[model samples]
Target: MTAPVRTRSSEDLIRAEEPVLAHNYHPLPVVVSRAEGVWVEDVEGRRYLDLLAGYSALNFGHRHPALIAAAHEQLDRLTLTSRAFHNDRLAEFAERLAGLVGLDMVLPMNTGAEAVESGIKVARKWAYDVKGVPADRATIVVAAENFHGRTTTIVGFSTDETARAGFGPFAPGFRIVPYNDLAALEAAVDETTAAVLIEPIQGEAGVIIPDEGYLTGVRELTRRTGCLFVADEIQSGLGRTGRTLAVDHESVVPDVLLLGKALGGGIVPVSAVVANRDVLGVLGPGEHGSTFGGNPLAAAVGTAVVDLLETGEFQRRAAELGAVLRDGLTGLVGKGVVGFRSRGLWAGVDVDPALGTGREVSARLMGEGVLVKDTHGSTIRLAPPLTITEDELLNALATLGRVLERSV
Candidate 1:
């Protein structure tokens, strides 16, 4: 008979990972054994309110019933049938997903980085084939301080030294421009430009929400310059920002949309590059493909996520609760928070440096039964699950307040 697995405490489990696990991440010290909705229970049976929500990947919360039901039903039937063969669930997923984003076509992939890479390839192809750019001369304009992905090519353009250092030599034909600066963007784009890619809200750069009209200005500039505008809505889309996409706040639509994070309903790694036919049609069948893209399981779960978004309940909750979040942060401005930037349920709070570094503050919050992550030096980001009740949010805020008070 197989030996029964030994149950371990949170500290024991954490210590066990140090030897075998890669040190690529410095996650908070919490061994979550079970989770439901907005709460997670550690191995020791202590519960904590999940405030970071998997960097917005768990926007619908842990083990969402509808999403889980879809996953279970699909698992019983089929899972992966590589792009070599058609999956029965792919058609509806593509149709509904494209419809949800007001796009004409979908090229499914797994992970946000894949979607960004795929979008880049499609844009370059369009530039050479349609825009008449010379071969190997296609250039993409991207904003500085961007966090598209960790892939070599993506990091090559990143302004963050931590993500870019020791990862080169990077591919060429890319231009870096200051974010939210239309004048600088206009100067950067020219005939060789394939696309201007940017995140609607810079999530990893501490939820940096651009000034009003920034997105619209990007759309207009791209249209005039004849370059495609690719919005990386991977972290800001699918009801996290109180809308289908963060670009919706300005009623602007880009030529290509890169989506991920919550698209899989927190069950799978699902991502896609969505675009109109003319832009996406540039790619031939033999040019690009992913083996597991649009598999049956991912399609089913993605379709269920789209169905939930169609009802707009999550978006409404994000918007209404966003006001509550904003007000709470406002109250904390002078208390412990020096400043903050917020959109919907997403926020980057800058706490007083005298209190402690962001990581230190996060550790303190963990002791108070709350979980959040730090972005930069003194900035901690908050992106709680949309399913969280008003009382839960208030309680989390109160917990933060108590932690800050004790620190002082």
Candidate 2:
């Protein structure tokens, strides 16, 4: 008989991590051992409702059966086959993803940052090759408080000092404008502009949703200026926002769509830059590639993710459950909750500073058997998995209410 595995306590694991791991992230104290659906089990066997859902990466929830089965089947057959040669699963994944997003072609990448970088390159290339922009003089415009990724180039344009401080001397040829301000965006777009990259809903900057008609205005401006409109939907896409893509809310289509996060079904890191042929086809042979971008395992998992979206069940769940979330949060407004912004099931709740900081509130919630994450100073972001049952979600909210009341 095999020896049973001995599990270490959460304290022991946390102590083990303190010395060796990089001090980049200040995560919540709870140490998760396993998770399924909307709940996570700590090493000490305590279960907590998961409200963050890995920053929307686990939109389908942890260890989804279909995704797991797909990954298992791929693992048994094949895994990696770098872009140096073709792989069996890549074409189908690309086709299905493209069809789902209404794009013509797909450039697979490993992470959201890579997809954004690739989109930047494609836009610059398109500006020179198709739009007749001067070489190396092309510029891309981005919104203020944007949280595309943490790459050097991506961080260079960030308005947040924490993300940019000491990370540069950074890259240039990028312009920044206030988010949701159409006048500023219009004024920034000129003849040398290659593209305008914006997130449909800014996830990292406290789930900031733009004003109505902002997306449509962006589309019209991009069209009039002959520049590509790149939507970084890495966090806001993939059925997290009760829509196939956040842009779908306005019925506006971007010239380039950057997707990631849930594309791997919370199983692997899979991302892609999707666009029409005229935009994505600007790259010639050897221009851009990734060693493990379209690997068999990622493709297999991505195909499964697309299949899940095809059923439209997750999207429906987010939309229906989102109403409940909104109502619950609204009821807490004056009770230690100052305000909140939400769409679908994703929310950024601002706890009154009189109670405590967002981090303190998060810790209290953890103590109450709920797991959430804090951003900025007083804002706690809530994005439970779409698979969360109504009862489970309400229970989590009740825990949140109790935590707030205790803090007060």
| Clash-forming residue pairs, model 2 | none
Candidate 2: tens digits of C-alpha lDDT, residues 1-408? 123235987789888999999999888887887788877888767888889988888999999999999999999999998988899999999999999999899999989999999999999999999999998999999999999999999999999999999989998999999999999999999999999999999998899999999999999999998999999999999998899999999999999999999998889999999999989889999999899999999999999999999999999999999999999999899998999999998999999998999999999998888889999899999999999999988888888888888887
Per-candidate local distance difference test: 0.94, 0.93
Residue-level lDDT for 76 in candidate 2: 100
Q: What C-alpha lDDT does candidate 1 achieve relative to the native structure?
A: 0.94
Query: Model 2 shows how many backbone clashes?
Result: 0
For model 1, the superposed segments whose C-alpha errors exceed 4 Å read 1-6
lDDT of 1 by residue, 1-408 (tens): 123234798789889999999998998999887889999888777788999988888999999999999999999999998999888999999999999989899999999999999999999999999999999999999999999999999999999999999989999988999999999999999999999999999999999999999999999999998999999999999999999899999999999999999998888999999999999999898899998899999999999999999999999999999999999999898889999999999999999999999999999999989999998999999999999999999999999989988989
RMSD of each: 2.5, 1.8
- Steric clashes per prediction: 0, 0
